[model samples]
Target: MAHRTRPLNLAVPALAVLLLALVLAPLAAVGWRGAGLSLGPADWSAVRFSVTQALLSSLFSTLLAIPVARALARRRFPGRGLLITLMGAPFLLPAVVAVLGLLAIFGRSGLLNSALQALSLPPISIYGLHGVVLAHIFLNLPLATRMILQGWLAIPAERIRLAQSLGFGPAETFRHLEAPMLREVLPGVALVIMVVCLTSFAVVITLGGGPKATTIELAIYQAVRFEFDLGRAAALAGVQVAVGAVAALAAWTFARPAGFGAGLDRGLPLSAPGGWRRGADSVALLAATLFLTLPLIAVFLRGLPGLADLPASVLPAASRSVLVALTSAALTTGIALTLALAAASRPRPLIEAAATLPLATSGLVLGTGLFLLIQPFTTPMTLALPITILVNCALSLPYLYRILLPETRALHADYGRLADSLSLTGWPRLRWLVLPRLARPLGFGAGVAAALSMGDLGVIALFAGESQATLPLVVAQLTGAYRMEAAASAALILVTLSFALFWACDAGGRRAAA
Candidate 1:
């Protein structure tokens, strides 16, 4: 057996316990407060709406992504790589920024409405269930496409060559090769998309427009903040957790490592770019391009004019956001690394579940619980920044853990015996063997955490006073106050900062790896 040092042995459960306390304490508080309350009919309405929208969003995003992924995979065009990179932007963009962008294109007096007016058609309202689903598709379609594209690209070139030699057409090729990959990939994609849509807070609240389109997450917010109904909020949070857990487990079951094979340093050729294939690919690419690019373009154009007239609160909020992001990044990276290392060494199911607990706990629930826990001791506002930092760290851990676990396991698998034989342990082992090997994932995970924390509005919305708002919450407040132009400007700044943080950290990772 490998020698276990006291510090290394103690760190695992310590970190695990810390994570459990951060997540579950708030949940327990909420449950204890609302123990006797049953869910009302309106709560049930929110539940139905939440599930229905999430299902529709996941279904449409996954279904639409297939042809788009196929087009991008088979037919290389001018700027194809750039388009692929831009597909990730929606994910990084603050949800408020994306909402602003979407509204700029789809809003009543926006470009689409103007076009409809010119064409003698009635302007359609960007509200209700369909609007919410559309927003979700906008956000998640790229995610689905990327997952599917990775799967498509993973089909070995030799297999493609075999199919070509056998005179297989597109139909035959898809039937034998692509169809199976899709079958393997789609469930995970759909389930992940569903999990995302299930949370459905920022986008749903923005586009949902009224009670008619409320999601459970949105309802939880309303119950706590608007109605001061802790019982209802607690009940709704419980529902969110229950649904989220099932979806998360299903997603985990279907999840496979996206096998993105290497060989891109050389010019590799593909087998599916002929006559009708060319035309179909062009249409798919163009449609996706127009759909994704136009909103961002609108945001840039509109926000440009508003930048000079931006409110006084924006800069302070931006600063606060940066602080929270950095703190959350450090905390998330540390905790995720610690927990991942422990899990890698031991492979305990309990540790793994604790690592993923945040996936089942929403920001609203955490915030509510934290608020309740702290309210009696001191004002929630007094500890707002600390609480936000902790909540953001907790929320980001699951993703960081995902990124770190595989790398940690690979490190252990490759170096455990070698390191043990050398009598290398503790700081020496970590510095010489683990740290250098882990720099890339650590940097990437930290980048993701920072960017996500920068954009997170949910828990902060629950805890922040007027003066304590983060950039996303500030943007929401601006929008609610009907300052659309100023809101756009703030959102653009938020989006820029989020992407910049991600790029810097990600670039640092790449440089360190190199």
Candidate 2:
């Protein structure tokens, strides 16, 4: 029995080593290449701007999410479930598509400016620091709302009932019951958003370029692409890595669990206060819905007309993106499953770290390091798609690992002994026990990885040549060329494909589970 398990144990550690190498090798390359380099004023400016925008974006996102989350938790209305489902969309949305949507409403020739002009008011700009922060808020606000809503939902119904029985009004209830939850939840929410925004590449690249708006991610791109300064790019990559690490560390340290004990599995409604509170909740719901959905609607409307006139480059690029997405999804799901299974047998810190350390690294930083590592060997363009797939796997692995770990652990606990006693091992054991039980999460995780890879514009931008461009890269190129209609059409196609992949995989998982 021990000999039978020996092979499995050895395989897990070998894979863990590979995963760690993939993440750490790039950092080592960056350090080796930029060992003696110092940041210039502009690089420092980028750092400052990056930190400032992330802080502002996280602050605004979390603060604004409170009312909206509270409203969703306390109020039950038509389309409420649908609205909650839609909230997940923006988080998974392709940044390039989201930018186009935002531009449709906020750009100089966009709806808001047009309306301002009609009203004899000065038009506003969406090409600066504010625009970057606005886009981050747009992307992360839903996530914060969702997290805070979970906190609200987790509160024991008995506490709310007790408050009501004691004749406690809204303020007193909030003080006694809700405030503590917020205290426990908001810090973690804010820090997660902060970490996400800290590695923002697309938002800053699209809406922010000037020194005042540049982030370290964008600066790395400029150093590599424009200045052809590998040293500067590597140095900037190190800074981005450090910032991400610090932010991740801060989140882990400060974001403690809510510590609220377990509750009975009974259904009870939260207190839905009447009068002005009802009106406020209604407004909050409406505002959040509009804020989220309007930009997407704008993208659809703008893209419809241009679909017939799309560039010839669009189809090939779309195909390439699909290929990359599918390949990345399959690879990520397989790797995550292997790691998850290993962890289930016996939890190991190294395995967990290997799965998650990528969270503290950005796509562009990985691209930069890979670019440096590959330059000495061959032209990066020749291997763009493969590198993109690899980076996508690394970037998307953590999400899949988190999704599959618990299920894998449960499967092991429930069936491990039985399988071992019956001499179940390797292929036979996986076929009968592991695959059947883990199929749902595996499917969903593959879907998430697929959607994320399809939408990713980061690494591909650094390595892709004209002939090798993916759909997101093509969209960015079209936009850069001021071909708004073409860009819109391409963006629409990208969004459709991304969502379709996600839905098919997710629905397939559900069907298989059923």
* Candidate achieving the largest TM-score: 2
lDDT of every model, 2 decimals: 0.85, 0.91
Candidate 1: give the clashing pairs: none
Tell me each candidate's TM-score.
0.93, 0.98
Q: How does residue 354 of candidate 1 score in lDDT? A: 80
Model 1 ranges off by over 4 Å: 1-4, 256-270
Model 2: per-residue lDDT, tens digit, 1-514? Answer: 6888899889988998898898899999998888889998989999999999999999999999999999999998989999999889987799989988888899988899999999999999988889998898889989999999998888887777888899998999899888999999999999999999999888888899987889999999988988889999999899899999999999988777677677777645679999999999999889989888888889899899989988999999999999999999999999999999989878799999999899999899999999999999999999999999999999999999999999999998999989989999989998888878887898889889999999999999899988999999998888778788789999999999999999898888788777
- lDDT string for model 1 (1-514, tens) is 2456776677777778888998999998888877778987778888999999999999999999998999988876789899899788777778888888888998976899999999999999888898888889999999999988988878777667778899988889888878887888999999999999998688877888565788888988888778978778877787788888899899989988534344334323457657988888888888998988888888888888999988999999999999999899998898888888878866787688788888887887888888778878897887888889998898898999999999999888998879888888878888887778998999889999999999998888877887888999999888777788898899889888998899888888778777
**Residue 173, model 1: Cα distance from true site in angstroms:** 1.2
